[model samples]
Target: MPKTAIVPPGTGKPLAPYVPGILADGILYVSGTLPLDAEAQVVHHGDAAAQTRHVLETIKGVVETAGGTLDDITFNHIFLKDWADYAAINGVYAEYFPGEKPARYCIQCGLVKPEALVEIASVAHLGTATGA
Candidate 1:
């Protein structure tokens, strides 16, 4: 059966769709995490690098909550509003993944919300262990 896990402190409002993480068939699918702060407000405005860092950190949190680590990531989908910021984004991304980066596809899209330049979604292999 598919299992869904919601990150703590649910906002009690439907701001964004989908739970933070879902596990099925040994794969954990993490939802796209933006650079939003604790208040759900966008952080690191106007700075692509900082925004990247913020979002990555958030991704790490979700991964851990799902009982996995960044190293377990097998694939990633990156969305960027401006392709020119790829270099800057990569520079910050390297710090998180370090070695053996996951396969990724980056696409330019019109973000649902403004002020967000990048969005990242990941799929991870949580191994055979149950309840990571």
Candidate 2:
């Protein structure tokens, strides 16, 4: 199967061995995204709500670059540093997917960057486009 890396503008190189997203067989597999600023430092400090928003926006860029919208997302994998922030994260997350919700799972776990309170990865399908 052929695959293409989905890298939007201003993505600034990641410090790992993976691309932001990969498009394979019309399915976009987004890597776990962190709430990091341009310098790759964690953002929002100890605020999980703000960090969740940033992570979602970063995922938005990857999905858009793959020619898909947030509504096209079928699943999401969310990781949180603390379960106490679950409600706050969901509050901000609902705003992004206001319509039909996607299949998802959230868990409390340690992230690659200790300062990052939340991380998210998603899968979206952008069916082959029809001719204009």
Candidate 3:
């Protein structure tokens, strides 16, 4: 299978030397996404719910660009700056993956950006495009 870098539009420039997402075979691997806006600036500040939503949305965009929706996500790795915000993050998470949610692991970790309370990475199965 061909390996393709999947970088969706409107994501702005990356802070690190890495692609936003990559597609290999039928799998899509999205890089750890922070709560950055289109200009790559930290958003939502200390609001964990909003920040979590932003991070998930960023991952969603990359997954869709690779020809799959959020339903195709098989697993996700979430990092939170504070364990106290766990409930707030889960509240927003429920809004996205309501039923039969994907496998996920959440842990508290120090994010690269101080204002970023959440970061997420995902694996999705996009299968073959209409005509690969």
Candidate 4:
């Protein structure tokens, strides 16, 4: 049977979507997180690097709620409104996944929200199956 995990909305930050995360089988799928604060307002204005860090931090919370760690991340999908900010984004991304990096794909496109420059979603392995 499959189970679902719920990431409670953060306090003093912003009211994250009621459904922040969900897990199925051994895969934990996190929603795209932006640099929005507790009030659902964007923070770290005009700084792509800072925004990226904020988004990643939010992802960390979601991952933990799903009973997984950053090391368990297997894949990451990044959406960016400006390709020119790739270097800045990478700087922040490296800080989060310092050693073993997950498989990632970054694309330049229009984000659903105007103020959001980048949004990241991830899939992680939370089960114990491993090669002997």
Candidate 5:
């Protein structure tokens, strides 16, 4: 049950002092992810849908690197700068997770980046089925 830190390609320099994701005890804990591009520049400023998509894509990359998939995601904690963008965010979210949706809690809160409309943190279990 050794712990491992993951920093996806093009993650660039982290805005804050935190690992992008950690694998420990058969679970992957993805830190709060933003819509930063390969160079770490925030993308899709002011657009919740696009930002959400980018966040999920980053998460997908991390999960795959850990030998898991979107289906392995069991929970997600979403933070939004505005609640008005809820519907738009959900629209993109459904496309990424069309299966038995992961347990999630989304709240309207101030994000680290002003232009960012959304940020998300997720947890995925990497059991024997998924080859931990």
Candidate 6:
């Protein structure tokens, strides 16, 4: 199966050489998304909840562009700048992934940007290959 890079219009271009997501073999592999705007500058500053929302929204864009939805996500890799923001991040995260949640693991670590409180990478299965 040929792979396709997923880059939705207005999504921030990362400093690194990587696409926001990649679709191949019926699955979308979303890269670690940070709370950045279209210019790739971090947003929400110290607010973990808002940062989580931004990150998830970015992931939503990637998956949606690749022909999937939040419900199609099967797993997530969450990264946090501080453990103190866990609950706050989860609060916003729940809003995006309501019921049966995807498998995820979060860890405290230094992010690419000091102001970025949360980052998330996701995997979504569309079940069938799209011409993406």
What does candidate 5 score in Cα RMSD to the true structure? 1.9
Of candidates 5 and 4, the better by lDDT? 5
Cα RMSD to the true fold for all candidates: 2.1, 2.3, 1.7, 4.2, 1.9, 1.1
What candidate 5 gets wrong by more than 4 Å, as runs, is 128-132
Better of 4 and 5 by TM-score: 5
* 1-132: candidate 4 lDDT, tens digit per residue: 656755555634435444567787778887777778878787887788999999998888888777778899999999998988899999999999999899999999987667888999998888942211
Off by over 4 Å in 2: 129-132
lDDT of 6: 0.88
What TM-score, computed on C-alpha atoms, does each candidate reach? 0.89, 0.95, 0.94, 0.86, 0.93, 0.95
| Candidate 1 residue lDDT tens string, 1-132 | 867674735322324767767777778887887777766777888898999998887777767776788999999999998988899999999999899999999999977668998989999898763444
User: Could you tally the backbone clashes for each prediction?
Assistant: 0, 0, 0, 5, 0, 0
Q: After superposition, how far is residue 14 of candidate 5 from its true place, in Å?
A: 0.8
What is each predicted model's overall lDDT from 0 to 1?
Answer: 0.80, 0.90, 0.88, 0.81, 0.87, 0.88
Q: What is the lDDT of residue 53 in candidate 6?
A: 88
Our tally of clashes for model 2 stands at: 0
Question: Which order, best to worst by TM-score?
Answer: 6, 2, 3, 5, 1, 4
Error of 3 at 29 (Å): 0.1
Q: Where is model 2 poorest over a 10-residue stretch in terms of lDDT?
A: 123-132
Model 6, residue 9: displacement in angstroms? Answer: 1.3
Q: Which pairs of residues have clashing backbones in candidate 3?
A: none
Model 1, which residues run further than 4 Å from truth? 8-14
* Model 6, position 132: C-alpha lDDT score: 45
Kindly report which residue stretches of model 4 are placed more than 4 angstroms away from their true locations once superposed: 9-18, 128-132
